[model samples]
Target: MTPRDGARISGHQYGAGGELCLEYRPDNWEPQFTGAMMIGSAYRLLSGESPSDGEVADVASAHRQTVAQEVRNTKLRLILNTTLLDILVEQPLLQAQPFTLDEHWFAKHWLAHPRRLGSPDAPPIWAAAPPLTEPRTREGFAIRLPDETNVPFEGSYAFLNTILTALNFAPALERMTASDAEMPLLLVHRGTARLYSLAQGTGSRAVYVYRTIVAPANEQRLSAEHGVLADQCVAIVGCGSVGSKIAATLTRAGVGTLVLVDGDLLLPGNLVRNELDWRAVGLNKPDALAARLDDINPSTKTIVRRLLLGGQESSASTDSALQQIGQCDLIIDATADAQIFNLCGSVACAERKPLIWAEVFAGGIGGMIARSRPDLDPPPYAARRQILRWCDDNGIPWTGGDGEQYSLQIDAEKPPLIADDADVSVIAAHAGRMAIDLLKGGATTFPNSAYAIGMAREWIFAAPFDTYPIDLVPEGQWGPDADENARDELGGLLREFFPKAEEAADEG
Candidate 1:
């Protein structure tokens, strides 16, 4: 009977009102739906057309951004949520197969990787390894997502007994009756990204626990596995409200290296938009944000420098500061300081590196998320000037809004443009997502762009997603290239300024 009386799971069958269950095709390999495989599946779904590196990244990014609900009474996310599993099954290889790991082999691998975390549920009985040298394979089934399983998960011991007998391991099954370990029964379902395991009741009836499999923390092969941020070197300027939030986001996304620059101590006001709490009020901005970042992701190497960019005139500290900016794979100017942004933008353009600069308008009326690709996008300084002009022509206030109480610009002497932390956080989250997307493009030829998202509650800024175009200045003078020799061991300049970077470098 094909699931007529009870749910059918692989070779097992259960009566009605049993625990949630799942099954696999006879020949599918577990753990094959990796990042590269997911990318392949997403590409195929995009119409059999071969995709560029950027295109594969674009599709897989959505999966990374998906939300998962909490696991049974835990902070960890459920790995095999119906929505996520649907996407995972997109890859052809994820189609169910007739395959099962040897019992000993499964036990060995499980024991090798100690349960660092998660539910400790296990099975009451054990099965011996199958001696079959060749596992069977089948085809002709149409591709589809796995059927939804019942909630309050469980498995059956009779199923394991059948498996043991069929594989000529009946003696082992008898020994399991005498064994004391109550480990949960684990199954490697065919064509699924997850392992299926359950704790069984030791009685005549089939009862089990709700324990389920989980995603390994070390799965960082691609954006699908680690949200496309596994190997990024990101340097962020200004670890204040906006900068601090963006830094936290980048770290959580698995950025490999992070440089946080902000010289000032965390003021009491910073707690509003800042991810940090009041305990960190006295700490330097970079230090506070760095510690917070470490807590978010210890693997993310964090280097905090206590020097405000553009806050100081030309000096050795400034030179070192510039070098710090020069050394990263990508530079994010979260600093609202106009002078520093222009300086950093020029250097990034000259070096052909990516630069993402974002800022919130006063009173959180709106904010801009702008990014430039070397040789492809406009210089950040040039782009910012054009954006400012656009805002001016559009009647965006530099200081106060209707009645002069709201602000749109952040001049050093003016009142705060975005006074509310919620407003700052709204823009910061948007900018953070954009930054991740830029990195996923992987050095592709995407255009330079500025994105503005307005908060409608303020009524002054009502636009949803407004795109502002910046004039392409092909001949702008960018600063020194961090790649080419710039400093000596003694911190003295070794090379003179080279303004002809455009002519010297390849446009591609």
Candidate 2:
């Protein structure tokens, strides 16, 4: 085989505007298959013609298959069932003239549910119309069908009405004056109808509205696998990088309601590792995260508490917050603050709810995720104590401790933490998975109740992605032990304050 002039071929990942990526065996490629030949075949195929003769039969077949797949992948923008247009289609016949569909028709006759956008460049915004008695007017024209021919590929208004004119149904077509050029024109062909938006100058283009139903967020297909998540309520403390990401993960997984607890502003510096963007800057973290979670899944409700837990709040207020957190199905302490963890631990143990927490190490080294269930693991403080001992036994000097296993926030005098977004995300995701497992209840995905995950070679981590799972055994029961001697002495002393039973009965 001989290479063509000006044909540049390199192993670079990217290519120029006209760069052609051709893969072939240098020693066994067909002599006739040259760069020019391939480009010519591509051009011919794009022009809706056979690429080449039998010299590239297999290539042509593969190209056709790819084109067919692309066509199949094309999805419609608007969605409405054929049944919705029956009344509008029949109204023109009763009036014996072309008619306009006002907003009332859209509101009463059409049903709509908001469609979730899967990507940024997804289809146009959906217009979901569920029947309401609201009187809203839309500039739209409707006409009776001409015949039962399949939907034509040509979208020109003139070309389509020309068929109506030939069928002697031109009266309605003539009624659509230039003033109504902007309105959508509906052409009914018996059971099916085609909608077209007539632009002022350009030819009309078909608005492909599918005749299918849209399910609400809770009823979406994801509900089948995540129905448990939809019914579970979770409270997340500390709406920072880890907390916000975990909240988003749970919301996307269809958690019914999130109790967001935080008292920090989303500063610009937080964007590098936090899930929130610049739009949330200066806003309270809990409120901002609530809005973000709604955007992710509208069905996931959020209750925002913009108070710094264990941080200068009134005892009454803190107790109220803890009471609310305890009511949730699960509590997540992403704060990694020892004091906050202790508060949350008290609530979890008293409420008999599951508690989960995680922390990303400084310098993006690694992180740890742990959970404590009332029935299985010890209290939150005891669990942290065990993890700290585990780290010490493994010779991993724990630098992040406020008399606890780890601390998410460091002192202002020390160097600033340096964990990147990816590092925080790794820990947050693991924490989220653990939360979901706790909510699902029964068999667990993670047998161990805690783990120390390494993202780089630091501390006890020998290599990147090193993981150590630590099993937690149940500790002693809660509350203080009773002393028989102290009880007997206190009983004799307290007997002085109260009357004897015989004297009390006589007085009564």
lDDT of 1 by residue, 304-397 (tens): 8888565533467777877778778899988766556655765576566778887776555677777776665556655666667666677644
Candidate 2 local lDDT, 1-508, one digit each (tens)? 2234544333211223333333333322578678776656445443433344533222233212243343343332233333344443554442232333323333224322222211225442223233223333334444555455545644666655564565564443453333344445555665455555455433344333323231222235553656788888999999998999999999888899999998778888779988889889999999889878876777787999988775555657777888999999999999877667766776787677889998888777889999988767877767887888888788757544222222334456656567778988999999999998788777899989999999887788878889999978777443221222333433443343234643676789
In candidate 2, how many Å is residue 289 off?
1.5
Each model's lDDT: 0.54, 0.65
Clashes of each: 18, 6
Looking at model 2, the pairs that clash are 103-136, 103-138, 111-129, 112-128, 112-129, 112-130
- Candidate with best lDDT: 2
Worst 10 residues of 2 by lDDT: 111-120
